[model samples]
Structure formats: C-alpha cells, structure tokens
Target chain A: MSPVHLEAVCKLYRGRQQLSWRRLLRPQPPDPPHIALQDISINLPKGNVLGIVGRNGAGKSTLLKIVAGTLAPTSGLVQVAQPVAAILELGSGFHPELTGWDNALLGLALLGLDAGASQQALSDIADFAQLGSAMERPIKTYSTGMVVRLAFAVTTCLHPEVLILDEALSVGDGAFARRSFERIMQFRRDGATILFCSHSLYHIEALADRVIWLDGGRIVADGAPQHVLRDYQHFLDQAPETQTPALPQAGLARGHAALEQHRIPARLRRIRVNGQPAGQAVELTCLQSTLRIEVDFTSDPSLPAPGVGFIITTPDGRSITSTSTIADGIVIGRDVHGSGTVILEFPDLPLLRGLYVLAVYLLSEDGLLVYEELPQAAELQVHSPGPELGYVLLPRRWLPLGNGHAAPDCKPSAHRYIRT
Target chain B: MRGVLLLLRRLIRAYGQGFYQPWQLALRHRHLLRQLLGRDAIIQTAGTHLGRLWLLLGPGLQILAWWFVFDAVLRVRPMARFSFLDYFLPSVLPWLLVQETLSRCLSLLREVRSLYERSIFPLAILPLLPLLLVWMIYTPLEAAVVAILHGPQAALAATGFMVVLAWLLLPWCYIFSLLGIFFPDGAYGMRFLLTLLFYFTPILYAPQMLPENLQDILAWNPMATLLQQLHGLIGLAALDLHHAWYPLACSLLVTGPAWVLFRRMSIQIREAL
Candidate 1:
C-alpha cells in the first residue's frame, strides 16, 4: 500500500466582511472566499522522500498539516497505510513544565505505546537529548535550542512509519544540524517515507528524490528535484521585482525594450533582475540588439583619467568577467572629463542563459578608487535559449592538418569573437 | 453491545497500564509528570507568596465562605431531624468533590494546550493529572470535614460507604476529563450550569422545604440523591430507598454514554489541541 494517498482534496477558508448598519438592514450575500487548496491529489509511496517548496503563503504548510492529520480537508479524502508522525512545529507536544524524560514518555504514549513501552523509550530519548542533569528540570527553564533538541530527540525515537518534517531542521546550531541530517538519512535508509519542507535549495537537492513547487496555493510543478527546482526558480524570476520610479528619456531608449513599454512613470522606473531592483545606477541594454553591454556616464571635467570598470557575475556569485578602463588602456587623466561613457562590448556574450549582476567601478586619473559598485547597478537575466546545453559556447577555428592550406580572402567582418 | 464491551475492555486495559502501576511508566517519566505538575503549580502560584500552600488555602477559604453564606447570611433552618452542621457538611463535601473533579476535568486540556503540541505527550493523561491532583487534596479534606462536623460515626460511615461510592464513580472523573479536552468551552458552560444544579440539589435547603411536585423533581437530582443517601448513612437523615435507587440507576445509565463519548473524543482531542 502507498504510504499516503490524498485525492481530490480542497480547502476553502471563509472570509469575513464587516457590515455597516445600513447594509445590515438589507440582506447581503457572503463575501468571496479564498481557496487554499484546490482538487489536490498526491500519492507518496513508502520509503520515498518528497520535498515541498513554495513562496510564503503558498499552502505548503497546509498540505503537510493535512497529511499529518492535524487538519482535516474541507472536501475529499486522505488515506494513510501506516501510522504517521509529523514535526509540524517544534516543541508542539512538549509540556513546558514537564522534564525532558517525562516528555519522552508522553511522546511514546501518543504513538500508541503502552506504559512499559513508553518507559523503555524514555531512556533512549534522554540519551539523545543529552541534557544530562537538566533533563530532570522543568522544560520551561530550558533554552529554545534545548527545547528543540529534546523535541527532536523524542520525535526521532518514535521510529514512525511515515515522518513528516516541516522546516524542523532549520533550527539548532551547525553541529546539531549535521547530526539531524545524518538522522534523516538514517530514517530514509530504514525505509520510512519522509516529507520535508524547506526553503534551502541545497538541502532539497541533497535530500529529496522529488520536489513539488506550489504557487498561488496550487501545485504549479511536480517532478524530479532538478526539474521542479528549475521551474520554481523561473517562477521566482518572473515574479514582479520591486516597483521603481519612471525612467529618463535617453535611459528609457537604452533600457530593455520590455522596460520601455512598462507603464511606470519616467522618474519612478528602476531596473530589476529577478524581483529585486538594482541598488546603484541603471545600465541600459543596447536598442534593437542584445549582443553587448553599453555604459553612458556624464563626465566631470575636474577629474582626469576617469577609469570605468565593469564586472559581471552569475546570480550564485560566480565571477564571469571583470575588466577595467586601465586594462583596456583608456587613460582617464587625458580625457577632458573625469568620467565618460565606457562601453564593454562583447560581440558574443559567453555566458549561458542565467541571471547575472553587473558591477561598475569609477576611478580617478592616478588610479585612485573614486567610486566602486560591487554589482554596480542592476540585475539582468539572459533568457534560456530553449533546449540549449553547455555552460558556455567558445568561438574557435579549425584549420586543415596540413600547413599548405590555401589562403582564403575575407572581408573585415563587423563582428569579432574572443576566446579566453 | 458486544463491540462496545470489547472496546471498553481495550480502553480499560490501556488505562489500567497507567493507573495504579505508576512505576511501570512513572519510574522513567516520574521526572516528566513531576516537572509538569510542578511547573503548573509554580505558574499557578507565581504572584502569591505562599505558593503551593495556596492549593490547600484556596479550598479552605471556599469551604469557610460557603459555611458563612449558608449558616450566617441565610440562617436557613436545617433538616427537621438533624443538626445544621451535620446536614450541611456531608452534602457540601460531596458537592465540592463533584464540582472540583468535573470542572478540572473540563478545562484540563485547555490548560495544557502547549503540552499537546509537543507530539510526545499523550493528551489523555492531561485530564487525568488534574483529577488526580483534586483527588489527592480534596479527599483528605472531605474526611477531615466529615469528622469535625459529625464526629466518629459520620467519619466512619463516610470512610466506609460514601468513600467507596465516590471511588466507584471515579470513572466519571475520567469521563469528564476527556470531555474537558474535547470541548474547552463545554467545561465552562457546564460549570455555569452546575450553579443551577447546586440550588436544585438539597445542599443549602431541605428537600421537604419545596412543594411536593418540586420535591419529586428535586429528588431526581442525582447528586442530591447521592447526598441524601450519604446523609442517611451518617445518621443525619432517614434512608429513602426510593430516592437511593433512582440515583444509582441514573449513574449506571450515564456510564455507557459517557464512556462512548470519551473514547470517541479521545481520538480527536490531540488534533484539537
């Protein structure tokens, strides 16, 4: 039998509306309701680990609570083949006044153990909690971390058939987290079906066999970990970034055409990568061409040899390229203004489709750092070329093996490709 | 009926595992329940200087206040056949026991809501703890009161018969304990309803004080009937077999329904908590 089967489940929350005296005089219909889950169906087999990921308020917690039997669905059925245990919230069943040992017994009792069995389980939980003499003291006196430790110990001792953990691992220190990770692995190895919810992508990637992405209280995507994570990341990227003021006239033309069409007022407009806008100044995309980066800066005549530097990095903080005016042999001291437009043109962007942040540095003539922007201004996303593979594409030439290859006459091409 | 009997037997087995043999579970978890009760007592007595003394003192004051209200303020006549204190003590002590046990059982779950969340603690034990505490403290106090008001005869009668009756009906305490966990508001509402029940019962007044029709209705009050039987045993009133049988039968009738409700609700109480 499957560990869990949820069929045609739907949860609806009724919204309350305040009625005025005048409105109350007449009959009024109920306010519209919010649907937390709609016709959701899921089947989890034994020994499988499923990770649920979603933005805040996406009903992931609700789904877990339903499966834990902490909540009953408004409609439909949830069938479980075995006894299920959930760490829905930390310290949920522990009595603040109870000692750690007492709580361990209580935990076992809740699992349907007899008194003798519960007593036997207490020692194991006590050992795991490692509170020593403090286990005899009231739990209310314990620190938050201590409470979490005790709760975790008691839960892990249950040897539950199906373990559902909702963000429980995010608690505790580094060492405890490592130990907990080991314990989760052990539980998995023992063939316990585990459902984990976490915002940590790394943990999900490492621990989960499958991932379900929830959006607007609905399952937007569900599949293998990598596939679902990719979809979720894309969903996050497309979500509206910070609302910005309108853009300036020349700035509007240089900005992405998508930005130019946005109804934002000229002054309020700001550049955004995913959902967050650039902190510094805005960099404009070339009009009608997406090939390279172009910077337009107003130069101050007082500052000489004003050097400009541009650094591009992937969203995960991998440095793609860093170039400065000095490296390009542009002497800012000789220029009339301390600052001038420094354009770094790459005829072919080497970066694969991914989100990238740009950083710009403005320097004085004597190579004194005047102003530096680590990820200078805003974020940019290079959209995925459908079905493209490889982290980067390199421009290379192949010549015939023999040295006597005929020389071919060629015209000066407008495009130039560089390989590093 | 057979299925119910089987389920009852199972429940009894489950409960028996924890009942008298505290060491079976308590040896390991003695620290746990102790800490829970200690913490509860501490928080309950925080602002008060006397601390746990308040547990004894609060009930003491309640008994004193009730004595003053009934003996002094109303100056109501006692039952035609007995001393005022004798008539009042037996009835008041059992009434106090019933109220304390039932009220505590009802709110037991709400008082331990946090403990319920910690998945490790079984919620069933929550209701039991309060009742257990009440039994420990109030049982002795009730005996002391009986001995004081009516001397050795009343004390011996209560110790033998009334005490046994209370123990036999102790299962009611467990039933109410489960009810308390299942419906927190239900406890408060029942407490309020018990105020009306107190007047209907012959706690402060003689049963014959009312009209015959009213006497018949008041005679049907289960707690009153139990009190009458208790008073009769203590030599404060005549033993009315007619009144005695009704309460015993009613108590029996209540047991099945209470057990069913308790078992059914016990499964859901943890979820509610």
Candidate 2:
C-alpha cells in the first residue's frame, strides 16, 4: 500500500446563511455550495518528505487537516498506512493557564502516550525547550517563542510514522528555527514520512524531495522539487500576462510551432516560449511584436564565443535590433561542452502594427556566424492599437489661466512630451 | 456489554495512573501545579485589595449577608427547638459547600480547557483542583461557625459528619467534573437547576416547617437529608436515621451511571476542546 493515499478527495466549507425563524424551525437539508477542493489525488511513498506550496486560500491547510484526520474529506478517501501526528499549529492544544511542564505532559498524552511514558518524555522535552526554571511557571507567562519551542519539543518526541507540519516553523527566533530544522532532519532519519506546508522556499528546497504546487484548489504540478518549483514560478509569471492580454490564440500558436532545422551544434531540449513548449509553439501570437529568444547552447572548451543572438525586423528585413553575449561582456572560457540557456527579451518594437520577421544567428567573438536563419524564420502580426495613441502614451499635465490673467497662446510642441 | 466493560477498564486505568503517578510527574517537574494554582488564585483576585484573602472573605461576607437578611430584614425565627443562628448556620454552611462544590465542579474543565487541550497532563486533576480549593475554604469556616454557635462536642461532631458527607459525594463530584468538559453548557444548566434545588433543600427553611405532604417531597432531596444528618450531630435536631440509608443507596446507584457517562464523554471532550 502507498504510505499515504488521497484518492479523489474533495472538501467544501459551508457558508453561513441568514434564515428566517420560520425556516429555522422547519429543518431543511444542508446547501450544496463552496467547493474548496475538487477531485485531488495523491499517492506518497513512505520516508519521503513532501512539501506543499500554495498561494493564500488555495486549500493547503485543509488538505493537511484531512491528511492528519483532524478533518474528514467531503468526498473520497484518505488512507494512511502508518500512524500520523500533526504540529498543525504550534501550541494549538496548549493551555495558557497550565505550566510548561504540564503542557508538555498534556501534549504527550494527547499523542497517545500513557502517563508513565508521558512522565518519562517530559524531562527530555523540558530540556529541549530550554525554559529551565521557567517551565514551572504557567505557560501564559512564557513568550511566544518559548511557547513554540516547547510545542516543537513535545511534538518531535512522538516518533510518529507520519509527521505533518503546517507552518509551525514560521514562529520563533532564527536559532530556534535552526534547532527545529535539525530535529526535523532527525525525524526524517528515523524513517518517518513528512508532509510539510511552508511559504519558505529555501526550507522547501533544502528539505523536500518532492514539491506539490497547488493553484485554484487543484494540484497544478507535482514532481522533484527543482522542476516543480520552476514550473510554479513560470505559472505565476505567465498567468497574469495571459489573463490581461486575452492570449489564448497566442498560447495555441506557441504550443504548435516547431523547430524545423538548426545549423548550430547545440543540444536544445524542452524549449518553452511564453510558458508553452516549442513543439507546440504555433499557437503563440507575439503580442508585443517582440520575440523572446531562448536557446540551450553547448560548446567545446577551445571555442571562445559560443553565443547566440536574435534580430527582429519588418517582413522586408529592415533589422530593428541585435545583441550578442560577447557584446554583453560574457566570455565562454571552456570547451567543457556543458549546456546553458541564453535568453534575450525585446521590450518594445519600433515597427508599425503589422507582420514582422525574426532572424537568428549563432556567432563567435570574431564575428563569424557559426549558424544563421535566413530573413524570416518566424512571422508574427501585431494587431492595431486600440484607442490609445502612440506606441505608449504619457499622462500629461496642463494648467488653465486664473480669472484675472490672460491666457498665453500655446500649441502642441514638435517633440511629444512623455512622462517617465 | 463488552464495550462497556472495556470503557470501564480504560477509565480505571486512566484514573489509577493520574492518582498514583502524580508524584513521579510532579517530582520531575516540581511546582507546576503549585504555579498553576497560584496564577489562578492571583488572577482571580488581581484588582481586589485583599487578594488571596478574597477566597475566604468573599464567602465570609456572603454568610454575613445571608444572616442579616434572614434574621433582621425578614424577622424570621428558627424552628421552636432551635435558635435562629443554631438552626440556620449548620444548614446554610453545608448548603454553601454543596453549591460551591457543584457549580465549580462542572466549570473546572471549561475554565482550564486550554490546559487540557495542550498538555499531556491527565485532565481529571484540573476539575479536582477547584473542588479542593472550595473544600479548604469551607472546612475551616464550618468548624469556626459550629464552635461559636454550639459547644466543642457539637462542633467536632458536625465537622465529622461534614467530612463523611464529602466522602460520600465524591462520585457526584467526578461526574460533574467530566460533564463540565463534555457539555459546553453544563455549568449554566446545573446552576439554574440547582437554584430550584436550594429552595427544596432544608437549608433556608426547616423540613418540619413544611406541610406533611411537602415534608415527604423535601425529604426526597439528598442534600436535605445530608443537611439533617449534619444538623443532628450538632444537637440542633434529632437524628432521623429512618430512610437515611435510602439517599445513600440512591447516590451509590446514580454514581455508577454518572461515572460511565464521564468516561464515555471524556474522549469526546478531548476532541471538542
């Protein structure tokens, strides 16, 4: 069996409604509304740390709660092959009126330890919490950091088969955070499966073997940490641009287009433009009449300049602009034949709103073109600008004459004034 | 039947651990309970000048007010055989103990819910603490009052009877403690119900003063019977040993179910809190 399996899980929160007393008196069926999770499925192996990353209100905590059995899923099943413990919120079950020693024992008891076992564990937790004599004082007198430290100490002592941490590490000082990380590593070493929810990218990268990206209450991507994180970042960057520009056709074009031929001897794999792969690049419309060029290039150690550049122009081949790695003060020093990607972005186009061509070149520092694309390798059309004037407009200010003053004659200047 | 047995076994085990292992736990983490009690006592009397004395003073003043109102304002006389103070003091003293004990018994779990929710401590002890505090305060005042109104023999006898009654009431205390944790509104409901119970009890009015039919009804109140036993020892009245064993037997019978309810509800209480 999978260590943890969430099959077609769904969660819904009931929104409060105002009902008349008459309606309240006559009971009605609960409303079907507010779906937080829609058919999510996950199968996690034992002893692997999984990090869940999501924007606010994306249902990460709800998913964790369901996994921890603190909450039941509205539909579907969450099956765990091992015992689970959660530090969902630090000091969640702690009593402010109880002493630290009492809370430690209480936390342990709640985790299913008998009194004898809890008593035995309390000393270690107390030492780890480092409250010293303060442990005798009521928890209300303890600082927030002290509370978190005590909670972390007690929770880590449980030795659970599956440990779920939900943003508990966000509290405490840096030293305490470091200590928590060390304890978590120890837990991992004890062959426990961990599901950690955090906004700390560094911690996620350092600890998680796999990462799940949640968007709009759905699992958008799940894979090795680096790959999933890169995809999530790209998703974040592209989502807003796509929404604002109505770029569905552009998306299709970017997905459909393919690289027919290439002269440069570079291994280019998994090329994506505008967040869509190169094989399906045809769907993308170059909205800004500007092309974003990226290529994976590898070179022999002897080659000084294994650089790539691109030129954008009208279909008539009037070159608009071009730049190269050598011109940008980058030096290719080794024949290491190692691979790296180069990116060039053209912010705006001077050409009129019409079809344009893109030309590509791979050259050395001596100006020898190792590879070149003829006049029009890629073609894109720039749609007519709406009512807005010029390529870009500035918000201008004008002052009117006061009542007693005569108005000075003024005319539009030869040079258009643009606000920075 | 098996589930019931299993639940009982578990409760027994839990209670045994809490009672027996407290010293081991306390020794390791010394002064934890003391600190909790101290904080509770201090916060309870923070703004008051008397501070911890309020624990004693508040109840003392309450007794004084009750005495003044009943004797002066109402001009009420004691039963023919008993003086006003002699009759009223014994009844009201125990009544106060029962009220204070019962009201606080149910609230103990709620007032310290935070402690139950967070720590590995057995929650049973939390409810016991409040009851213990009330007992400490009530016991001394009870002795002093009996000594002043009656002779040394009567005072010692009354104290002995009160101690015995307290022991008999342990099961009820435990039941209320658990009820406090499980039922969020248990304390308020108990208070409202106990208000009616106070009148029915023989605290404010002697049972003999009621009509014969009503006397039978009043005698049904376990609190009234307990008070009568207490008053008898203090020489304020004759001991009515007849039907005395009934309330004791009834209390014993009720205790079994009450304990079962407490055990069953404790699990749910942990989750609810």
DockQ of each: 0.20, 0.12
Interface root-mean-square deviation, candidate 1 = 7.2
Work out the TM-score per prediction: 0.61, 0.54
TM-score, structure 1 vs. true: 0.61
For TM-score, the strongest prediction is 1
Worst 10-residue lDDT window for candidate 2 chain B reads: B18-27
Q: After superposition, how far is residue A419 of candidate 2 from its true place, in Å?
A: 23
RMSD of each: 14.0, 17.7
What DockQ was computed for model 2? 0.12
- Give the worst 10-residue stretch by lDDT in candidate 1 chain A: A262-271
Please write out the lDDT profile of model 1 over residues B1-273, one tens digit for every residue: 999999989667655543343324434455455555655666666557797899888877887787788778877767765666767766776776677777776776767776554343543345446545665666676677788887877787776655555544555666767656644555667888878888899988888888898988876678878887787877777776676777667655555555445545653554454
